[model samples]
Target chain A: MIVGDLSRRELADRLAGEGLALQFGPFNLRIRSNLGSFASLAHQLYEPYPLPEPAAISDFHVDISAPRGLRRWLRRQACFGIDGQLPFAPYTIEHAFPALEWGINWCVATRAHHLLLLHSAAVERNGRAIVFPASPGDGKSTLCTALIHSGWRLLSDEFGIVRPEDGMLLPIPRLIPLKNQSIEVIRKFRPEAIIGPSFLETRKGTVAHVRPPVESIRRAQEPARPRWLVFPRWVAGAPFTLEAMPKSQAFLSVATNAFNYEVLDEIAFRLVTEMVRSCDAYSLVYSDLDDAVNALDKLSQASDG
Target chain B: MLVSPLADRLIWQEWDDIYIVYQPAAAATHVFNETTVLILKCLQQGPLSMEVLRHQTEAALGVSQDELAANDFEFATTRLEELGLVEFVDDPSTAQ
Candidate 1:
């Protein structure tokens, strides 16, 4: 009900008293729950404009208003109506909106034509996209946060939705979630960065989110051709390094890490093959953000040269 | 009926300019260039004999018979068959 115009606190109260209704780009969602859990649901379901303060109280608890039996069914199926089509899962109440945004990211990812989802972080500057596809604890987010604060545009902090049809990296940039030392590391690097509240003792070890820069959000529709595929690893006390990886080996690495690669079938294979062929693949190991940024800058300059 | 029946079993995927398709269980793989995807999509409707495939491909892709030959259509057919996407179909009239 014209929900996008509401302020963060008003939106929170409205969602609590009434229900959750909001739109994110192309998708719209409505959730009905009691006041107790509505706060969490609200934060998760909507991207609070002019992002709320770090210590601001975020209400994450709400009670389901549906009948006991229907509630059980909704949970069991994990399905929710999106634009009237029942999606694979409901957007459950997350402690932070970033988590819910990630769910929305997953939702849009499946609908793209022949696009494979990759567990990576991508950032762009001057039309060139750099993808860091890696597993959890590989320090991709930390690297991405560092890059964005250093003037790179964040494409996405998690999934690298690569369209197989055109080999373009679609922008699905959201808040970059950081954990434990990464949060502190980024704070030291970019003190002005807007960070969400940290959910302590989470499975990912005290998780927090770095708000994506506004420029990235403004250019959300822009698609960039991947120029570098860097698989980063955080190694304590290691010198900042970038090593070239073989194309054949790089192909396997990317295919295995891709989210919807297998589902996209032949198109997935072709897109990845094209991407790997065109971009220079490297393995980056670092313990310091400054050193890593310097190394990336050198690479960027060389490409331009 | 003109396309190889074995072509049905083949799995082909092209991304950008590079193409790779293979049958793992059959232990066969084939690679093609940008032109192969157009060829595969044409054959996807059903198996076609080599002559018919060539003629249809010529019409669909707007290439001359000689140009089609230059693309190594015969080699592509063999590769597709090896990948199990196309196969030989018995002509019913001949059998009768």
Candidate 2:
């Protein structure tokens, strides 16, 4: 029937069994999968917009009818609709939802406002927000999980959605995905934390999502002005260290990590420039999550003071 | 013929006092100052005739008539074009 009538789980099942039918913003996507590598396809379809472009338009639908043998063995399969023909065999909705999410984000971003998506997690404390931006495997998620458990509000784990107009971060703190060791690290750190199902042997080793704290989810609509930009690197045995970064260097580092910085062109530049200017930038390297959290707490206190 | 070859195929975006131009395929981003930012913004909506661009820039910046036509405006526009910050769209009817 109509999308409004079906629940997310029901829609997901329909897409997995018969085929998925849902509208993401302006684009209506329908996917059919056999439940094998369909999850992979869903991820691709829903992956965040790589570059800010108009919402993708796909009218001609594809029929991906896969044989049992192919379905059971396939790790991932994807083929676009060409001319009027469905390029390949059946694909499932599990793989398509993630792709739609990403595509919808891209479409909304490009049309409504330029978003500078950063590879960072943000949290709020006492009316001020702190952003932890670091490369993958830097223990950012681990630190973020610890802070949230300690009463800091989680803003996001994978993305830092910054509005180009005011440099305010839009808080859509969803599940914080933790990889391999970090998952165990967080598990040990916050015994009460509820972690999602782990997808073992996937591309990024053991991957599981840490559910956002209930408070964070409840305050998901609260946008925060960034007060600190800390680039964190997890060093196994090193003591906690915090160093101020030059604004120029911080500017370049942040721009390099920004998702839609280049796409937004001048607006992105100004927004980021203003953001970094208004916030304190630092390099935070630590081994222990407790120590890292302490140092951040001190930093935020000093900033507020 | 007066067009600086540098300004071709460039797209400029302005935010407040900052102006930035990014060449997508080239993966290059250049930042500009307030004056240049305003100049780029003047050309952003669509290509305007140089005369119209100059007047608009003057009005936006609140420059006097004499200072409006000064060498600074011409020099900045030339340098911006040289740096691949603006472009000329060929209109057959306007072509001399």
Candidate 3:
């Protein structure tokens, strides 16, 4: 069953009562929430996701709800709890869905050490995937959003979960939260983008979420072998430039930028070295999205990884 | 005095001219330039003075030793010592 199959009342009821069991990529999350606002937004944004069996064991039991004490009655706030442990401070009540999204990402990135977790965005075309290792102001999510809308399949915008045993990228196509001005950028780029309500004064200044395309959500189980590592940045009025980076330098950047490079240790060294060796690495700078897209599309077609 | 490279404790990965060495004992990883890697390779034979290391590094990197090259050699070995990848040891011959 898909989330869209359920009515708003039914979705809310499932969330409040026994919890709503949903499959997010490889994870089975049984989300339990009592907040009406969170439920309404989640139902809208996650309508494309498939539901796991009600009796299936959940990898995580996540709670998004108002904190205890007078805070729940006055100037309301939301908190995230996983398996009875509150991992973060309370956010304003309206940021509950963002809290839920970010909380889930934290749970996976911190707990799932068995897989190589990279702070990157990945998208696939023709059985080949390109990974954009994320850094501050790198325009990773923006490029990922644009690519997915323009005929590429979205592997993920936040988590780059690679299976160490085989070096394949597992798709965890969740909500892509566009922050501040990027929200407007994406809206103008894709007029038909299914964005949830924008919440202001949250942690990331202002934020809005773009729902994953239904086709991408439906193909969540499909994993793609990574082919290219492109480090991208958006600079105002800069001409498009894509330059080859030395493999050793690429290794350092990718390893140091990973969320758990130290935790994995030798496995990280081996896999990262192999990944860089197998793929061509480049540094890209562009001001225009059209030029960026065309260049990447051309690269994907021109060479084999 | 001579410098000793702690090669026994390191895990080295090479791609082209650069090396990624992981010190499992310290749980630390470091990227080595060609010069640093060449110095470590030369020192693995035994502790060597800067004069001896300079000759070996020049041969390995295929460069003629001059003032600038010697300075770069000192810089590389200094970096190795800073990273605890190498240490100074008393030369046995001199002790005698």
Give the winner by lDDT: 3
Residues forming the 10-long window of minimal summed lDDT in candidate 2 chain A: A45-54
Q: Categorize the docking of model 2.
A: incorrect
Candidate 3: DockQ?
A: 0.60
Q: TM-score of chain A for each candidate?
A: 0.77, 0.71, 0.97
Which pairs clash in the backbone of model 3? none
lDDT of 1 by residue, A80-155 (tens): 3334344333433343243344445556556544457887899888889999989989999999999999989988
- Cα-based lDDT at residue B96, candidate 2: 79
Root-mean-square deviation of each candidate, in angstroms?
A: 9.6, 10.3, 2.1
Q: Candidate 3: list runs displaced more than 4 Å.
A: B14-16, B64-70
Worst 10 residues of 1 chain B by lDDT: B1-10
- List DockQ for all candidates: 0.06, 0.07, 0.60
Error of 2 at B93 (Å): 35
Weakest 10 consecutive residues, lDDT, candidate 2 chain B?
B1-10
lDDT of 3: 0.88
